[model samples]
Target: MDYTAQILKNPIFKIVGEAADEMQVETYVIGGFVRDILLKRPSKDIDFVCVGSGIALAKTVASRLGNARVNVFKNFGTAMISYKDWELEFVGARRESYRKESRKPIVEDGTLEDDQNRRDFTINALAIGLSKHNFGKLIDSFDGLKDLKRKTLRTPLDPDVTFSDDPLRMMRAIRFATQLHFDIEPDTFDGIVKNADRIKIVSKERIADELNKIILADKPSYGFKLLFHSGLLKLIFPEMVDLHGVDIIDGKGHKDNFYHTLQVLDNTADRSKYLWLRWAAILHDIAKPATKRFDKKAGWTFHGHEDKGARMVPKIFRKLKLPLNDKMDYVQKLVRLHLRPIALVKENITDTAIRRLLFEAGDDIEDLMKLCKADVTSKNDVKVKKYLSNFKKVEKKMREVEEKDRVRNFQPPITGDEIIEAFNLRPGRVIGEIKEEIKEAILEGKIRNDKQEAWNYMLEVAQKKGVELN
Candidate 1:
């Protein structure tokens, strides 16, 4: 089928075709942009493959398009041009053969068919002709259009060969399935299962990238289930895989932390698009396996799982090559405090408790509440309703307290520096002790989280301490 009209709608398409014709290189728009076009998904990144020097074609195209700058990568024989909203990448069509030791391929100039053959999946191999004579003509030598119609993903060549050549393809298979909400062809998925260990040859950064895409899906659990069954999760993340099974003792069993984690992840994803919040859900109960114990009287208990899970975050992030900065910290904080609000539900709630939650949670109180609420993945509707209702009350109390006390992320109005000046004392443990006392007083509702009140309270405490102003 020809999409000539669609091709003509964007002037950049015509410019690219004319530039390719002038350079005398056969060119076609291929890979994701083509697939997304057919899927009616909006894409601003376009990959164009040409038979000859793609750099020359890109330079010519850029020159015609307001003398735009073309960024050329001589090592890869590729060029990129940013044209308005679209990022245009041009690469020469080439065939590749992989070495056993590495996923990097040996490249040689080849025809369009060769380039299409190298594509990871059938849907991604679809291409559209860009030259004047064959403008917008669809190319689907591997039945990519058929797979698209079936809403299934399959390897363009032999599935084993496709995945073995580039183990990252295994992760991409699951990522695509999750992102597109499509199914993997049975044979193709089996290939993933068989070649799952080969994913170790791929870098952690690449695997983490694909994992993040899966986590961001509308339903992340689907991707995780695929990863688990394929055995890829074990190879890539055994810590998470360890959460798989329920252990039984004395005729009692705990929930499968693996599937429970996935449920919470999906629940969090449904509420917000924040990737780290979903990650918080994943790790919130990660240490349950390590902390699991049977009390016989009280059934199964995962004591200190939250604290252990919070400690586990840095190692997991480091192993996965995830950012070790504030994003990791955010996930860690949420994991540690996930049960705090729920703990409040069963106990007698007080201003001190609310103030502590508000103070510890700070700006993330709402996100923490969301993760905690998502934590209640119960089969019983009444149980779920009760948990959610209690969470709502906790949220209400937090809001009211925040408005009244202005204590979300609030520091004690008294500062150590001020205390040092007030008492004419050196910076030491005494100052640290005083600051803690002030913060504690505010959090305990003895003071109103106000400067004057904290100052008055600090003076009283300092007087009791027998500190002399020098």
Candidate 2:
């Protein structure tokens, strides 16, 4: 199919073609840009593959565009140019063969067909001609177009050879299936299962990248289910796999925490797109297995699972090579406080309790409520309704407390400096004690969250402590 009209709509393609013609090398738009255009997905990055030096073509195109700047990677034989909002990458059409120990491939200049054969998936092997003779022709040597139409993910070559050479493709396969909502062709999926162990050779960062893409997809659980069944989850993340299974004692059993976590993940996805919050949902009950116990009276109990799960978050993040920054902290805090709202729902919803929760959750109170609401996964309609109604009451109480006390992320009206100056004392336990008391008083509604009330309370505490005023 000729995409001349489509190519003409964007003047950048014509400029690229003109540059390729001047360089006297065959060039084409290939990989994701071509695939996404056919799928009608919005894509900002475009890749060009040329028969000769792609770096030279990039320089030529950049020079022609005048204002565009080209960044060349000498080691990788590739170049990049950012024009307006679009990032264009240029690479030589080359074939690759990988060593057994590494996913890195040995590259050599080759024909377009050779380049296409090296692609990880057939759908990605589709290319659009950019030469003068065939300015917009579609090239599909591996029936990639047919597979694209059928929404199937298959390798351009033997699945075993493809996966063995580069194990990261295994993760990519699952990621694509999740993101595109496409089916992995049976053989390709079988290849992933057969070579699941090979994924250990892949770097944690790359695996994390693919996992993040899967999590960011509209239906993340689908990808995770595939990972679990295909044996990849066990190899990459055994902690999660440990959450599977139901143990029965005297015909009493607990729900499968693995599937339960997935349900929570999906529920969270339906309400919010924040990746870390979804991560918090996945890990909210991660320590249930560790904390699980059974009694004849209670059947089963996962006591302190929330606290244990919160402690496990940092270790898991370190293992996964995820950022050890505030994102990880957010997940940890959510995991630690996940059951707090439910506790409030179960018992009396009081202003004091609401103020404490608001102070702890701070600006993330809304997100925490979202997670707590999603945590309700009961199949019983009446039970679910009752829990939801109770949650609404908890939410109402939270809002009232927040508006009245302004305690969400609230700082004590009395500072340590003020306490030190007033008591004429050095920085010590006394100052911290005073601050804590003031914060506690505000949260407990004993004193208003105002400077005057806090100063008066501080004076009373100081007098009781027998500290001399300055």
Candidate 3:
């Protein structure tokens, strides 16, 4: 199929074509740009490969445009030019060979066919000629159009060689499948399983980047299951793998936390597009394996797993190379409080309970509720209905309590400094005690969230503590 009409509409391609003609070199719009054009996916980044000096061609193009800036990476022999909202990358056609110890490829200038042969997947190997003589011509040496039509993922070369050369491609394979909702060709999948161990050589940061992409897919669970089955998950993220399997003692078996976590992830994905909230769902029950216990009456118990999981979030983020900023703290807080809303659902919830949840969860209370609701993955339809109905009630109660108390992310009406000044005391444990008491009084609904009432309560507490109140 000809994409000439569609591509010609964009003046950038014509400018590049003119620049290539001036340089008297063969150039083609290749890789993801070609793939996405055929798939009708919106793409802003454009890649072009030429048989001549890509750096020199980039400089010519930038000079011709007169407005775009060329960013050159001399080490990699690639240059990029930004035009409007689009990024155009130029690279000389080159062949690559890898050593067993690293994925960094030894590069040597070669023909366009050699460059296409080195592509990670067939679908990405398609190219569109960008010269006056062959402008808009489709070049598909590996029948990439067929794979695109079949919605299949396969390497242009041997899958074993492709994955072994760069095991990160295994993650890329699954990531592409997940993003495009395609299936990995069986042989390609087998390569992933065989070379799963090679993923260890890749940096944790790279693995984390791929994992985040998978997590952001339309149905993240599909990618995760593929990761688990391919054994890649075991090598890259053993903590999640440990959540697999079910152990039974005396006819009692808890649900597989691994699959359950995936379900929660999908559920959260459906509710919100926030990546960190989805992360919270994945880690909500992470400590189940560590906290697992059996009792004759209780059947199975994961006591304090939420607390343990919260504490584990930072360590896991540090290991996985995820951002340890507010995003990590957000995930940790959700993991810790995931059970609080459910507890309210299962019991006779009070305003005090809702207030504490709001205060602790702060502005994240909505996300926490979404996580708790997703956690209710029961096979019994009736049980699921009951839990959902109870959750609605809890939500209603939270709204009412929030409207009246205004306790979400609320600071105590009385400050520690005020308490110290009133009591004529230095910074001491007594000041902190008074602040806690004031916050508790507001949360417990024993006093209005007003400065006068809080000041009076502070004085009363000091009197009770046998300190003279000014």
How high is the CA lDDT of each candidate model? 0.91, 0.92, 0.92
Give the C-alpha lDDT of model 2: 0.92
Among all windows of 10 consecutive residues in model 1, the one with the lowest summed lDDT is: 1-10
Residue 333 C-alpha lDDT in model 1? 97
Query: Tens digits of per-residue lDDT for model 1 on 414-441?
Result: 8888998999998899988888998898
For model 3, residues 1-470, the per-residue Cα lDDT tens digits are 35656965799989999999999999999998878877899999999999999999999999989857899999999999988899999999999999999999999999999999999999999998889999988999999989999999999999999999999999999999999999999999999999999998999999999999999999999999999999999988899999999999998898989999999999999999999999999999999999998999989999999999999999999999999999999999999999888888856788999899999999999898888888888889999999989999998998999889889879888887777778788898888888999899999999988889988998898998987765
**CA shift at 168, candidate 3, in angstroms?**
0.7
Error of 2 at 199 (Å): 1.1
The per-residue C-alpha lDDT of model 3 at residue 428 equals 88
